[model samples]
Structures are given as C-alpha cells and as structure tokens.
Target: MARLTAREALSYGMFGNAAMLQNALDGKANISLASRSLPEITRQLRDAIAKRTVSAEGYPEKVGQPAISTELLPWALFEEFESLAVDHTGETVFLPPGAPQNIPRWKNVTFDAKEILELWPIANQQIDAWMNADFANNPLKKRKDRISDCTRAIPCTFATATAAFNRSPSKKRSRGQRATNRP
Candidate 1:
C-alpha cells in the first residue's frame, strides 16, 4: 500500500477514473471518503459482494459447540463465474456490471490480440519514457511537449498507434458484413 499513494488506503483517482470509480464506490458519488481507512474494509466489501450465504449443514453439537456455516454457490467459488459476475471490486468498492455494448460498434471491424501483444514492447518503452520524463506530474503540459497529451502519455503515441491502425485491414463494407475479433 505504501507503493500506492503512500497510504494504507487506495485511491481510484480522479478526472478520467472519476465516473467509473464513482460507480464502483458503494455510496454513489461520495467516493472521496474512501481514502481515509484501512485495507480490512476492502476485504469486507469483496466478501459482501461475492458472498451468497452462510448456511449451516447440521445442528450444533450438544456440548456448547457452534454450527459451522458453508458458503453455498457463491460466485468466487468458481473461477470461470468470477469473470462473468465481478466486473471489478475492492474492499471499499464494487462496481456494478455495466451495460453490454458492441465491441467495435461498426461493421467490418476486428482486432487481433496477438498482434497487439507483439507491439507491447514498443508500448512499454513509450510508457517507461513517459513515466521517467519530466512533466508527467504537471497539471499543465510543458510548451515543447504540448503537441497533445497523447504524445506525453502512455499507449497513445501517434506514430505507434497510427502504425498499428494502418496495419489493421479497414475497408468499406457491405451492409451484410459483421464485425469480429480475436481479443
């Protein structure tokens, strides 16, 4: 936790992540209060989200023994279901499932995940450079680096993104065509 914002609490951050984090934080838009507590809250929140039941299989023994409860059919018990059920969660937050939408939202569009993986090294280099570069912390961009925030940020380098875009096969398609992907 020290590596993350130097506090026991976690910050989902603002501006870009504000809405999504707001949706995730339990109390609607009152997310700012989450940065003031312990990690146990997060664990409890995850349990609350995935917890289905605490049911007893048998009666307690006669000698002041307690009944042990079992978690029945909770989503976390199954690895595959966890992906479907939980979009995101933490101790202090659980983002509800979002509305499903078309992946490309356009006909004749597709993605090759392998190709993206191949380009990851270049993307990583750009990201490292961006992190090590001065001005990443500035509220305003430096004049020389201000072609656009894309040039100063990770994964949005014009040359690399444009090259990847151009590498993809795009074309005018007939109305009958459908988009597909391998990602």
Candidate 2:
C-alpha cells in the first residue's frame, strides 16, 4: 500500500469516508485518532460532516451515547467561537460583539476561521480538479489521484516541524564536507 501522505492524512482526518478513517486507524498511519492533531481532526470531521461523507450511523458506538446528529454538530462546533474575551475582573465576563480578538490565538486552540477557510476550499478544489484531470476516464486512477491531490494540498505542521528538526542537525555540516561525502 502506498504510504499516506500528510495531505491525505489531513483529508482523512477532516472529511474522509468511514472506511478510510478505519483503514487509517488500522494501518497505524501517523495521523490515527490517538496521534492526530486536534486541528486536523476538527478539519476532517468538519469536512466529512459537511460533505456527508460520514453519516450519523457512522459515528463510533461508545458508552457516552452522545447524540450524533450531523445537522447539529457543525453549529455546536461553531458555538465554541462565540466569544473571544478576557475576564479581567476575576469573574466570568462575556465578550461583546465584534471584539478584536487575536486570530492567531484562536488558531492555536482549534480550527480558526482563517485556517478552516483556507483548508475547506482547497479540499473542494482538489476533489474538483482531480475529477477533471487525467484520471477522469479511469475510476481507479481517479481515486488515487484524488487522494494524492488532497493530501498534497493540505499542510501538516507536524510534518514540517519534524522535517525542520531532522534538517537542523544536518545544516551544521559545511558545504565542502557535504560535497566531499557525495558518491
């Protein structure tokens, strides 16, 4: 099986089919439920629910028996961003409408408006482009291409961080040393 790319992981984590998510979990992909970033999960769930990729019955059966209504989940998730206020009075204070909240701070917490907006459209574009591309006439190839395109477009900060970490040590080596070591 081809290794799941960071972009695919994001898409699967955001709006992947139920079978796809299960497959990802079973395969122990880097972005399994236990290991996936919350933003990625949020994006995946949001996208899936929005696109009807995951139906109410597709939600995992658990003891909590949380109501799994696709219609409500989106609004419930959106409610989290109801206010961006600081309670300076040492008491609970509600933020007024149109408060000038820091957007980056929200991004750090969950899928902020900016990040969601950036990712959602790209996901749609990837799917649409894949449908119209070279794979249009081939069902199997189209599936592969869609997955590839989706995964390629989505950004994975964890992957970027890891790459940076790996490269940091190597960056110290002089160019002459690198050149001399080449085969």
Candidate 3:
C-alpha cells in the first residue's frame, strides 16, 4: 500500500479537484481511494511503455539465460535442400533439423581487392610502427596513434598516385590502321 503525490495521481488521472489533489499530495485523504482504483493500472501502463523501449539482451546475466543464448548452423555446412527450403523473406533465414527458430543475418561482405592491394603498403607500415612501439615501450604511442600516423601518411601517397589512376589510357592503333586526313 503506497500513497502517490497529487502530481503523480493527476498524471495517472486520479482526481480533478484542487483540494482533493492537495489532500492526496499531503498524504491525509484519498490514499485508499487512489490505491484501490489504480492497483492494476500501473502494471498495464508499464507493459505498454516496455513495448516501446529498445532493449538488448547480451549482458552477463541476460547472456546466460536460455532465452538469450542462441545456436546457429554455419552456412558452409548447410545442405542443398535446407538452403532451398529456407524462407528468404522471414527474420530467420536458416533452419536445420533442431536448430533455433531465429538466427542473426550473416552477410558475406567483400572489400575491393584492387583497393586493398593498393593499401597493403600502408597496412605494413602501420603494423611495423605498432611492433616498434611495443618493443620500445613508448607510452605515448598507442594503437590509435599508429592509426593516426598511417592516416596522415596515406594522403601524401594517394596524392602522388592520383594522377596515374586518373589519366585516361591512350588508345593504341591496330596494325591495319593508318592516319588519314579526312574531315
């Protein structure tokens, strides 16, 4: 049995009269009246509010719960029939004999191979800097410092190479082709 303030009671649509509202706030009268009327109301209100709240369930305790823990079948191990039978539009895409009802969507995203090849030297330099920092025990040079240095170095390398990539290749003439002055 809890008594709510007038403001709280008003928020819950308990009473309209100013004097009655004051009495509720003062904890004198309307204590029993409000509680009796709004006993199950708060539960319904909470349920409604909870539906709108964004929630994640991977914290230590929540992760340990059977409801939160999920098992997934690897796409590589999926049989041809199972792949064909999966509902592509639904939330869960894959299901083996006894697999969980829902599985997070796994995407096979790929980077531009040529772009990656171009960045290889930059990656090597960053790795070397990181190793050197670790060996030297440099307190100021953190992982992010190495990244920042690499980012700074990349623009200079990119500027020099920009012209080469941007230049349109000259079209070569075929063996049979010859220059003819025809306008």
TM-score of 1: 0.19
User: 1-183 in candidate 1: lDDT tens per residue?
Assistant: 011111111122221122334444545545443332324433332343355321111122224545354222333432222222211221111224433332111111111222222222234334333433433344233333433443433334566533432332333223465543321
Compute each candidate's TM-score over C-alphas: 0.19, 0.22, 0.18
Estimate every model's Cα lDDT from 0 to 1. Answer: 0.30, 0.35, 0.31
Q: Which candidate tops TM-score? A: 2
Candidates sorted on lDDT, descending = 2, 3, 1
* Tens-digit per-residue lDDT, 1-183, candidate 2: 223323333443454321244444557444443334545454454444345343211122235566253121233323354442212111111345554433312111122233333434433433444334423333233233444453453332334323332333222334344323232
In candidate 2, stretches whose alpha carbon ends up further than 4 angstroms from where it belongs are: 1-13, 28-122, 132-183
The local lDDT score (0 to 100) that residue 141 gets in candidate 3 is 37
| All models, RMSD in angstroms | 19.5, 16.6, 28.5
Q: How many backbone clashes does every candidate have?
A: 1, 7, 0
Span of 10 residues, lowest total lDDT, candidate 1: 1-10
What's the distance in Å from true for residue 144, model 1? 6.4
Q: Tens-digit lDDT track for model 3 on 1-183?
A: 233221332223232221343566577765554422332333322232234221111112233344344233233323322321112111222333455534333222122222222222233333344334442443233334444553343322443333322231222223466544321
Stretches off by above 4 angstroms in model 1 are: 1-84, 91-148, 161-183
